[model samples]
Structure formats: structure tokens, C-alpha cells
Target: MLEKKLHSLSLNQIQIEDMFWKEYMELVRNHVIPYQWEALNDRIKEAEPSYCIQNFRVAAKLEEGSFQGMVFQDSDVYKWLEAVAYSLMWHPDEKLEQTADETIDLIAAAQQPDGYLDTYYIINGLEKRFTNLMDHHELYCLGHMVEAAVAYYKATGKRKFLDVAIAYADCAAEHLGTEEGKIPGYPGHEVAEMALVALYEVTGEERHLNLAKYFIDQRGQEPLFFNEECKKNDNKCFWDDTYMQKQYYQAGKPVREQEKAEGHAVRAVYLYSGMAEVASATEDAELFKVCEKIWDNIVKKQMYVTGAIGATEHGEAFSFDYDLPNDTVYAETCAAIGLIFFARRMFEITKDSKYTDIMERALFNGVISGMSLDGKNFFYVNPLEVNPEACEKDYFKRHVKPVRQKWFGCACCPPNVARLLSSIGGYAFECSEDAIYMNLFVGGQIEAALNGKKNRFHVETQYPWEGTVKIKVENQEDSSFTYAVRIPGWCQNYELTINGVKPEYYVEKGYAILNHVWKNGDEILLKMDMPVTLVEANPRVREDIGKVAVMRGPVVYCLEEIDNQDQLQEIYLEENPVFTETFEKDLLKGVVTLKTQGKRLSEKNWGEETLYRPYRGRTYEKQELTFIPYYAWTNRGIGEMTVWVRI
Candidate 1:
């Protein structure tokens, strides 16, 4: 039934396929794409490395023994390139993919006869095979490349990148596996497994899938991890922290028992999501249940009000459940990106609202929260609250302070957002040809062939700000189709009209179905009320109780100390305060400011009394404060900022 009108495509399709990936691709076409193409052309011109080994026909051979001192940073670049390439696939940027094709060939040529591929090993030095996990990020790098290649192949029906990915995956299958004579396949970090599965989709080659499966299956098996301390000589060790030093690169417990998300948050979620996809593809019910368990535990207790996950600064890792302390929360940008991946997979697995709910929340508030509104600067850590004044006091703790930053060393969000946006159309709808569901409201045009007929839809809306969606539908011929639209959990009323006439589909649960005969130029208008909604985290999240966060149409709003008289903690938005906002077109494009009366608690009272009473009567005069979108904070010269404030 989903095949008829709307597919789950509108879901991720708007964000990943349309908005994110497409924007990123354009960004590339504008800046990075040209640079990459030039770089590839240069490489082809120079014939890098000098014929170390003969590779695929499309590839240029690398010279023998040129890159000896490099710390495998070159290896990681391939992954980024691969991501770039695949991002070009569904988004269809030929020039970039062609450059990627050349790079893929270069990678293939670097491979050893037995299937090993590493320029350092084959060209420059020797025998550094899985010898350094902590510093290398080798497997993690390859995994991304493989994934990018596979995605590119699937999207474009092209195999240039795929061949290189297969060759590398084949090499891993040969040597780095759990079976005897094979090295156990667990990345020092855990992304390659997922990447392999993504790679496997193109090959449909069982070995690649099995190799990916083996990495996941072999996790927590026996040797938690192959300790490379001796190899790093203990001094200048990759994982310097003693606690991290003692950790098992791969855990030894059954995957289900591996409940608390361990390791780096990005690695953990990427690995888990890959495992979920494998489970679905393989029909492994146990893995699916395990995924659900982990998902439930995360959203219920660990995720931030912004839908950001991961809570500790130690490894940018997950802390205990419900231990989401806002000031100290290390909600990494990559973790939120990973959450999107995990949540989307969960959406496909169960077709449930909960997963998409998190997906939507993260996509708008947390994930995009990582990127600046202008599409450049990104925040590596998206903390909920910050006392900019306190940051001067506790310097280290100040890292948790929420602010928009230029870029991170491990800049994953930019490309991740890019690829997600480019492929967003796919997320909007999914179908086997019977029914369609509108998951997200983003203004866009789509043309899809349905049931031997061509159907097109042009959705016009100012969504994520206003809740109105008007869809103009066109078909080759008059026909009957069923369209399902999601009724948000937050909205009090859902209204729909067909051909300017008021109509209700008899909503149940959260899905409203409109089944009807359609004609060319027919219109469907749906409006969801967008009132300023105050949300509170569950009691388990002790950091959020007694504090309220305001969200208007997916964008979370916050109050900066700049806009308030006292520090953020001492201020509160008066109940039933008159609020007014206007879009300031100049000098910031668009500005949404909220003016509300707030009474600041007296800090002087505490200073005067030697004996401190924890509770005191509300002091200080009521002050008017202007609240802006949380994404807009810190631009006004780093002052105390509060995302969630006392009611």
C-alpha cells in the first residue's frame, strides 16, 4: 500500500536526500568539488607513487616507497573522498564521482597480490598490518571508503568505486577475520563493520557481507582486543589514557549483553546501526530485539532534550542512563549524526513512530544544531546549557559550554549532512506501489512512477517554522490513491482540506489516511498548529526536571545572558508573559526573538548570609528577556546561555 502515493521517502528524504545531501553536493560543486577534481587531475598528471602494483583498469598505479613518514592520514582521506563520491551518486555529481573513480583506482593499485591495500605497506615501508589500532584509525577509514563506494554504486548503477571497495573488502575477508589464520576483525574503533555492510549492498557478494558480519559477530568474543601496547612501546602510545589503555578494543560479551553503549559514541552508533541493517537483511530477530532494547534505553534515559546522544566528555561516550547532566553533557555532533543513522534504520525495521520521532527531533534540533545556519561553522559538542561566566572559573568544564565552532579535527558532520541532504528524496517515500505516507513537511517537488502511472507532487510549505503544507498533485491520468500524513504527537489539532473543502480522515494513533480518487492539479492542504511548546525531560534525566525548554516548529529556542539582566540560572520566564517576535531580514537574514518578563533571583542574598539556605524567596525585579533560537546563541560575545530554564 505504501507504494501508491507516499513512501517513507519524505522522512529521511527531505533531510538526508534533499536538504542535506543536495546542499552538501552543491557546496562541493561550488568549492570542494572543484578542488577535489583539480587534485585528482593533478594526481593523474603526476601518476602518484610510481607503479607499485598494477590495479584496476580505471586506476593509476602508485609509486613504490614514497609515503613512509605519513601517519596514515592519507588512508583516512580516501574515506572522506569515498563519502564525497557516494554523496555524488544519488545526488548525481559526475565530475566529483569521476575524480573519486580515479582515487578508487589509485587505492586498488596499492593493494598487494593477496588483497592487502595500504600505500604505506605496499609502497613505502613494511608489515604494519593491524599493528596500531589506536593511532591508525585504519579500519575505520577503510570502512567509510567502502561504504561510500557501495552507496555510489547503488545510486548510480556504476561500479568504478565499487570495484575498489570490493578489492579492499576481499582483502579483509582473506586476512582480517575471526576464523583461524585470519586476524580478528574488529576496528580499534567500530565503523568499518557498518561501512562493510554498506559496501556489501553493491557487491551482493556474500563474502563482503560475511566479513562485515564476522566483524560484528566477533566483537566481545575472546580476546577483547589485541593489545598493541608493546607495539607502541608504551611511550607515545595511541590511546594514552590509562583507562582507555586497559579497554578491550572489541568487547567479549554477547552483543545483546553489550547494553551500555561503549567506546566512542560515533563508533558505537555506527556499528550498532550497521548491525541493525544486517539483522534486517539477514532476518536476525535476536539482533533486532537487541537494537530495540538499546534504542529504548537511549531515548528513555540518555538522549538530550535536543535529541543529542552521548553524555560523557571522557571519550565523548555514553554515560549511565538518565544521567544527562546538561552543563557537563558531551553530546557530540557525530553522535547525533549517528543517532540519525540508528534511528532511521529502526524506522525501516519496525515502521514505528517512536524511531521516526527521534529521527525528526535529531534531524532538526540536534543534528542540524551541529551545523551553523549558514552551512559552514559546526559545533563538535552541542551542550544544552552554559554559564559563560562560570567558564572563566572552571576552564576545563568550560569545554562543555554550548557554542557554535568553526570546525572539528574529525569533521564528519559537514559531509554527513551533505550526503544526508543529497539523498533526502529517498527518505520522503518508500513503496511497493499501493499507499504513500508524508513523513516530513519540506517544500519540494517530486516525480515518481507508480503502478504503471506517473505521479508528481509539488509540496509548498514554510515548515519547521509554520505548520502549513499545501501539496499540488499531478498525475498522467485520473486515478485513485491513498495518502497518509503524520500527525505529530505535539500538535493538539490536525486539520486537512481537499480542494478547499474541509475534510477529516478520522485520525487514529498518529497517522491520518486520506484515500480518494485524484485528478490533475488536485490539491491537498494540511495544517498542524505550531504553538510554543514547553517540553520537559522525564524525571530520570535529573538535569531537566523543574526546567522547561521551548520549541516552536522543530527549532528549540534559548535565552542568552546578553538578552537577560542576570545570569541565565537566576532568571525565569514569567508564566503567561506577553511574547512578540519579528523576522529581522537585514543583518542576520532572519531573527526570531522572544521578549518575556523574568524575575532574577538575588545572588546578593546568598553573599550576605553566612549560613546558606538552599531555598530563598524570589528576589530581584522582573526583567524583560529576549530569547532566540538555541542555534543563534554565543554569536553575541559568549555570555551565560540557557537552553532550558526554570519555569
Candidate 2:
């Protein structure tokens, strides 16, 4: 049987007052957003110049400088604009709005008369445009532009940006497709497929939907459009094919025929997300099953304990199953954000709590870890283990930085984090005609329509720290609908009650289904037992075979050199150790810290001059080890950090 489709509440319809998330939202609005704007204008010192705004200005002929930065530099601006739109929904600022408006006008002015838009081609030679879709990211930039346009229009009901997106999409539809005289190539980075679907939803244009389907259907086909393009361009390949082949671009085979997740981590998830959206829109069960297979392969075999992906730094791509190494993993911040995007689309299709579970896992751990608490610094690569000396001396571990960076020449993670954090309310809840699903325990007030009646809910909780969630129902009329609350996969024991009385409920797809004719002032309380769990990886994972990771609720914990002296690799958690949890308000802007008595190999036996010792049993010294949330690590001074500890 086909499941009823679910839809997420728009950002404006939901307001978050979450103790944990509100602070992040405020950071993005007040600091991150403004900081990024300055960076875009090349105003921030000690940071790599963005040249994003200047590139757009140059393309518009408002300035005479040549194009600079990455091929997708324009995407940073679009992502920031999208974040601004979401922020304005909850916290409106006239100056910020005016700045966004002026930026949009500049972008509009940069558009070609034929509706084509891309600063790279405008500032560079137009004749060379679309010739290198395999590397140049023109379509990728278009996708982010459409997404930002949709978000801006939805937030403010302004059509200026929407019209710009419509024109560019029309231009794409005209130039690239299966139609006669049109190119048959798709985005090397796969966001356009899903962005076009979003544009279709707003514009009610069949061409947009058809274009999206065309992109998905055309990928990995015979003759490999990318190879043909390369051939046409005199066999000139911009990026080396050593690590990134057709498979690295996910164009080796038809997407449905591809079984496992492969290629650049960000591109793979973006493509999978697009496939999931198209599958849902078309009701293609076969395609959705493919999404299921790839998703399982990711979370089950290739993912980190902190919900991070991309096991290897070679290509920033997935390696074989059970190949999750700690110190050398890539786990790019953008990949985690892309994973959340994929998870949300899947949950909207099936209304399953399993999808939401992974979403929350990535949200609280991997995604937020991309940015520092102050929101001024960012991490492009999130590693489970880091050693400053190794990072400096070891070529293989060079990508694993012990501290966050202020900015990057290829600055994609910061604005991506900003947009996701700003629109997080959309991921918190989804609604259908007769049911409402609370996907995450984000404390907020959501106004959604249920059975043709407006229903308001105030969700209150201290999540990740405490698992008790109290949802107060407010409605003008009595509503008979199913309130599906997600019971996290990590939670084993939980209690659910309605207005102080236990209610009849059943579990399906990891959600506790509460069916009732709800009334105003009624309260639903869910208390999930939060215990500091010791999680062991599958034995097949060689690196983590004898190690265990610490987690409480959805937050993964790690030991930092600041808390537990250096040489984190030498520490071992005692067998059957007892952990004590304390809330430290002054630490990392407040977090729950875990402490346990553990053992460390005694180094006194070996003298500084002794390079080798006789084969004897190692001596151990008992020490108290403290663990902070994985996301909170490195916020203090730089040092060694590891998530998995020897047992």
C-alpha cells in the first residue's frame, strides 16, 4: 500500500524557543550572518578573501575586476541570502533586509538578457560556458540560486528573486535537456534536481518538474554524457581522474543501478536527496528502494559514531564497508548537512521515525560540530580523532586540524551551516491531512493544519541533556488526529502520557502513535530515559574493534586534551566503569560533561633515551577522564581529541 505523503511546515509557520537551538539561531542571525557578509565583501581581516560579492559586481559590469575564487563562489552568496530569508521570518531587521534587497538587485543585473545567469561565464568567456559542466559547477550554482530564490519568496512573499530564478531555470530548460539541439548533461554536483523540484512546487510549472526528472533520468546513462563532453573538448579534463573517475561523480552507472554510496561525499548525498525527492513526487517505488539501499550502506557500514560520513580523505568519498578509520577520515561539514537534507526528504515520504533518528543524530553532533560556539570560526573537515603533532607531521593526517578555521578560500561550510540552522524549524515537524509528526524534540511552537482545522502546539523540552518533552496542545476546535511522536532509536525506556493519564498507543516505524480527539490546554508528556551509553562498533571495523564510544541521548561524547591530558590514544576506559554526569554552565556555553575512572599506560618505565624495551606487560595508572560532547571539543585550546577509547 502507498503511504500518505507528508509535508514539512514552512519556516514561517514554526517558531523555535529551544534552549539548545535558539542560541544557535541567534548566533547565525547576529554574528554568523553579519560575519559572512563582511567576508563576502572581502572586509574581514585574517580570513581568506571571499571575492563573492565582487565577482557578482564584476559580472554586472558594476566593477571592472576579473572573476576570482572557486567556480562555485557564487553559491556562498546564495546560501547566505537563503539564510537571511529564514532569519527574517523570526527576526526581521530593516537594514539586513535592505542589504539583501540590494544584493538581489545586483544578482538580477548580472543575469544575461537571454535569462542565463552565472558569473563565471559572464566574467570569463561565455563561449567556454557549459563546455566543462563536469568541473565548472555552473549548474550547481544555478541550483543554489533557485533554492535561495524559493526561500526568499516564501519568507517575504516578494517575487523579485522568484522571477529571477524562474528565468534562469527557463534558460536551463531551453539549453540543457534531451530535446533536439539541447545539451544532455546534468549537474556534476547534484543539487539542481532537488532545487528544480522545489521551484516547481512554488511556480506550479511542469517544465521545472520535468527538468528535474530529466536530470535524474539522464545521469549515468550509456555513452556517459560527461565522457562525451570531455571528448568534445579535446579530451581536456580539468580535475585529475586519479581519485575522481566517473564513479567519483556518480556517473559510472545509472543511479538506480548503483547499489552503494560512492563518489565525493557531498555530491553523493545531494544526488541521493534529489533521487528521493523525484521518487516521492513521481511515486516511483523502485527508485525509493534504491535510496533505502544506499542509506543503509551509509549509516550501517560507513558512518562514524558522531553521524559523520566520508571515510577517506583521498577523494572525500566513501571507502569500502568497515573501512571507517578515525584519524584520517574526511567527514566534511557540507556532507553532514547534505545527509540531513536526504534524511528529511525520506522522512517526508514515509513518515518513519528511523529517518528522523539519523536526522537528529547528525543535527546534534556532526552538523553543529562544523561551526564554533561563537559562530565566527568553522571546520571544513570534522575528524573523530585528532593529534596536533600527527596533523603537522603526518602527510596522511594533514587534513585533520585540531582547531577550527576562521574562513577558507573554498568557503562552503559556514554559509551552509547558517542556512540549515536558520531553517531548522522545517525539519522539526511534518504534517498530513489527518496526522502530525513531531520529528525532533526541538522546543518550539508550531501552527499546522490538521483535518481542515488549525492546531497549535508548544513543545517544551531540555533535549540532549534531559529527555523529558512536554507538548501542550492548543486548538480552536476539537481535532481528531494522530500525533506521531518520534521515539529515538537510542532510547530504550520511555513513558508517554496525555493530561496526566496513560493513553492507548502503538509503535510503528519507531514513532509512538497517539490517536485522540485533542482539546485545548491538554498536555502530552514523553519521558525518555537518558543514560550515558558505551557503544561498541561492529567487529568488522578494524579501527574500532576494541574501542567504545560514549554517548548520551543523541549527543556523542569525546575526550579532549584540555580535559584529559595529552596522548589521548593511551587512555583506556575501565571495564564496567561508572560514569557521573554534571551540567557545566560555564563550559562551552553550557553542556553536560561525563567523568569516569579510566587507566592510562604508565610512561615512567621508559626513559627518554630508550627507543625499544623488552617484551613485558605494560603498567597502568588510574586516572579520572572527563568527556565533553563531540561538538564542543576544540572550543578550548587546541589539543588531541578522540571519540573512541580503548577498553
Candidate 3:
């Protein structure tokens, strides 16, 4: 592992002023969070009943109602609170903060005297608390609560919620472990590990960190904890060969021994993130090696062009190597967000650009695709190719929804998108005492300590839309430090200059670094070559043969039925096609649309009645094709969309 120690800035210390990211942050704060709160309270009449808030009220004895929503429904509220906390870091809202604080109070009221906090098991029965650890989400809810508590504590410096979370963590630590009389059960959903680590970070409790490490180390051991838990759950094992096997939870083997990516995509990534955290915090290089192996396995073999993973719709799990299928893919939005979480932790561990490259790829594409333009609607499953009819009729494609939904009973993605977007500033840059690393080319202002001095700077750019980015140093001391900008993996040729003069620099691991002293008005202008290129899949990926996807900068473009009209199957890109970039301020929230030349099969040459024809020369007509960012396609009334086109 590279020993270049790097650290991520706190969301409280950074503000997003970039046009591209600012719009999204505002949307989450102004639209998604409020709408999600309404949905959680079951106030949105047309949306599916979340009953999330109702369950908490019932558990708190303030309302008389049975537990309604999923076992993990409490997480929805926790995630929203987390988002609200992040939003409060920059834009303070009294009512929103009041609502979140009140919600936390309700959650606190529902807690058992022993610090048990899961409402489902509390409202259902105390006896069922640890009975169904394999499928139930008791620890999962606690994990989200811990994360929210940490965010709230960091954002507001309040210890009320943090104490509640720590109490819950202490309760879990007391009940579960490798010690005798304690159940050796890890979370089936795989987040408590990371959440406990976050708690340890804030509270400096060795128990929390030790508990997180214990869970990771105990997972997938022979005579598995989950298998034993399932056996105790009335001899019911999800690994009965019919349902989701143990591998579906990544508990089939020891984490260090398992090299392949498996199980639910979200759970796998979350667990991997926790492993990375424990590896870094404990300085366990062997555990980190496992993380590296799995990272390579996912990125090199199983990842998609849009940076989405998990190919199979079944269990939303990762398939074999290079088994990525576009039309039947299951790239859940939460999974992409989880990938970002995992990738960010990896970067903290190594400061490698490869990890941040994947992080940006997922952020600009798959992760953002989860939310609609209005931010009120969300897509749980993001498929690269969409066929509206097949989504309606095909049983195998039933999970693939053609349009974004306002809400769902299992509403994970909406709040996930909200939290990620609200706290996006933290992912933009990482700084050390002597240097600052710009992981994402987002236009934002940051005030951070570098080289034992306070520094301030503003990043201005319409990135992923325009390749030219300008970094203006607003305030800095007369001291030396390194300022590294990530050169996206897609950009080949680039130019970097300081104060309109060419600067000498060296590229290291995909970052263009400029180190100097005494900078107050120093301006760095980075011009990256953003030529439209057709990206081809590896030959082993059977589904993408003879197909190419459009990419410019970090954004991947796609063809939509609304743009192409019809016969999407007949459109083909020529050997060498010229593409023109145009920014439509009114289109898809002011995005850069691509226009290219292509050929479509002539309608007069073949009738639509025949399914097949004998081998014969086909005639084609030249046509103009318009491509939009893959993430922006479904917002315009999803009809059909595809990332790969015939070459």
C-alpha cells in the first residue's frame, strides 16, 4: 500500500458552490428531503405507505398502530436525518432541524431501558430480538442510527443523539461478541461494522472499534454465525439452496479468504467498506490486501460502463467475471452509493487515483441516476437498457422499472440518494497537513488547514460539461504545499498553467501535482481534452460485442427513444463519426448534449412484419443522432434508453 497519508475533509468544513453540484445539493435539500419526510410520515397520499414515522410513534406509545413498513423502515428516518444534518452544515433551516431533532426524540423514546432501539422487534416482541438475525435488519437500523448520530454530532456539535447512538452501540457490544453467553452474530445487512467504526471515530471508544473489527473477523467463519443464527431461528436457514444462499450476504467464507465479489451488491460493498476502515484504523495490511483483491475483481471484471455493478437481477448480486449484461442488469442506486462509500474509504487508505476514478464514475453516472430531475422521484434499480414493454411483461425484468417512482414500501434508494447528495462536499477533496488533493473537479469553495496554516480556495468549473477548470487561490500563507488535481482517466491530453503561465508539473498515479510556496493570487488553469469517444467493452464481455458507448469527460452519454424517435435497433455509428458538443441551457437542467452522425436502416428496404430474413445486403440512410447523459435520460418521460449502440 502507498504510504502517502491522506485525509478527507469534513462536510462541515466544506461548502459546495459549484454550479453542477450546487444544483443537485439544493434539489436534495429543497425537494427530496422534504418529500421523503412526507413519504416517511405517510402524508403523500399517492405514494406507497412508508408508515415509517408511524411505527416509531407506536413504539413510543404516542400512537396506537401495529408495525407497518419493512423491518429496516427505521433506517429511512435515520438516513433523512443524516441528510438534514449535512444540509444544515451549509444551509441552516430551523424547521427542518426542529423536525429532525423531534424525530430523534421519538426514536429515543422508543428505545428500551437497556438501550435496544429497533422499533420492529420492540413493537413486535422482545423475544424476537435476536432470533432472526439472518434476515431481519436490527443491526442495520442501528448502523444507520449510528451514522446519523455521527453526522449530526459533527454538523451540529450536539451530544444528545450521539449519546443515544453510543448507548445502542454499547448495548449491541454487550450482547454480541465472541465471548461466552454472547451470540456471535454479525449483521445480515452488513453496515454495523462501518457504523461502529464511525462511532469510534467520534467517541474514541475502543469497544465500538473492537466491536466493528470483531464483526468483520467473525463473519464467514466455519460454522458461520449467520448459519447458526438461522438454525436457532427454528432451524430456518436462508442458505437452504433455494432462497438467497449464505454467499448472498457475503457470509459464506471468511472475508480475508473470499476474493470474488458476491451476494447483494449493497451489502457486499458496505461490508467491504467496513473492512477497509478496520484495516486502516488497526493498520492491518493483510485485511487491506483482501480489500484490494475484491476491488480489482469488481472494477476489472464485473463493473459496468456507467460505473454500476451487480449484473444479475436475482438477489441483485454480482455475477461471474465479465458477465455484465446491459438489458437485464441490476445496478441498484443504493449499490452505486455503497460503491462510492467503499471507494472513498479505499482512497483514504491508499490515496490512489484508481479508487477515486471509480468514485467519480459512479457519482456522475449511476449514483446520480437514482434521483429524478425534480428529486422527488427515485429509481431503485437502474438498468442500462430499458424496454418499457419488457418491463411490464417479462418476469425476469420485473425489477426493471421504466419510470421513476415517487415512493416504495422498501424505500432505500431515495433517502440514500438524499444523504449522499447532501453530504457530497466531503467527497470532493481530501487534504493533508502539507497538501490538498482534489478528488473531484466540482466547483466549490473550501477552507482547510495545510502545511500548518489555514488556506482557502474556490474551484470554478462546469465539469463533466466543460473540461476547462480554474482554481483560484483565495487565501494562503507564504508557505509551501502541494495542490494536486485529479486528471480523470478519460482525459488523455491536458494542459495545466499557473496565473496564465505554463507551469511545470509531473503526473503521478493520475493526479497532476503542482507544489510551490507563497501563493495568494495564484490561479491554476487546467484544460483537459474532452473529445467524444466510443468506448468498447472487453472481448470477454459477451453482451457488448460489436457495440460502443459514448463518453465525454467523466460523463457517459446514451441514446433515448425521444431523441432517436424509433428503430433504435437500426441506428449504427460509422467507423469515424464527428460529434459536436452543444450546451442546451433549457434541456435536462442545462446539460451538454452531444450530436453525432450515424446511419439507420431504411424503412422502405424492409417491412416491419418479418422477424427474420435471409442473408442479404441491407441499405442504410444517414441520420443525425442526439445523445444525452445516461443519468438524464429517464427524467424526460422514460420510453427507451441504451448505453451501447451498434457500431
Top candidate on TM-score is 2
Model 3 misplacement above 4 A = 1-4, 242-244, 605-609
Residue 165 accuracy (lDDT) in model 3: 90
lDDT of 3 by residue, 1-647 (tens): 43337877887678788779999999988888889989998999789999899999999999887998899999999999999999999888999888988998998999889899998988889887877777888899989999999999988888889989988888888899878999988898989999998898888879899999999999989898877776677757645574458989898889999997998999999999999999988988999999999999999999999989889988889978999888889999999999999999998767779999999999999999888998878888888888899999999999999899889999999999999999888888888888899999888788888878888888888888889988988773566789999988888998899998887788888888888774788889999989998999999999999999999988999999999976587889998889999999999899999998899987775677877889688889998999999998788885888899998
If both were scored by TM-score, which would come out higher, candidate 2 or candidate 3?
A: 2
| 1-647 per-residue lDDT for model 2 (tens digits) | 23437887887788899889999999999999999999999999899999999999999999899999999999999999999999998778899999999999999999998888999999998888888888889899999999999999988899999999899989888889887999999998889999999998898888998999899989999989998998898656544456557888899889889889988899999999989888887788898899999999999998888888998888889878889999999999999999999999888887788788999999998999999999999999999999899999999999888899999999999999999999888888888899988888889899988888899999999887999999999888788899999999999999999999999999999999999999999999999999999999999999998899999999999999988899988999999999999999898999999999999988987889999978798889999999999998899888999999999
TM-score of the candidate numbered 1?
A: 0.83
List the candidate 1 regions with Cα displacement exceeding 4 Å: 1-113, 118-126, 132-135, 154-157, 223-252, 389-395, 401-403, 501-509, 576-578, 603-616
lDDT winner among the candidates?
2
TM-score of each: 0.83, 0.98, 0.98
lDDT, candidates in the order shown:
0.63, 0.91, 0.88
What residue runs in model 2 are displaced by over 4 Å at the alpha carbon?
Answer: 1-4, 238-244
Give the TM-score ranking, best first.
Answer: 2, 3, 1
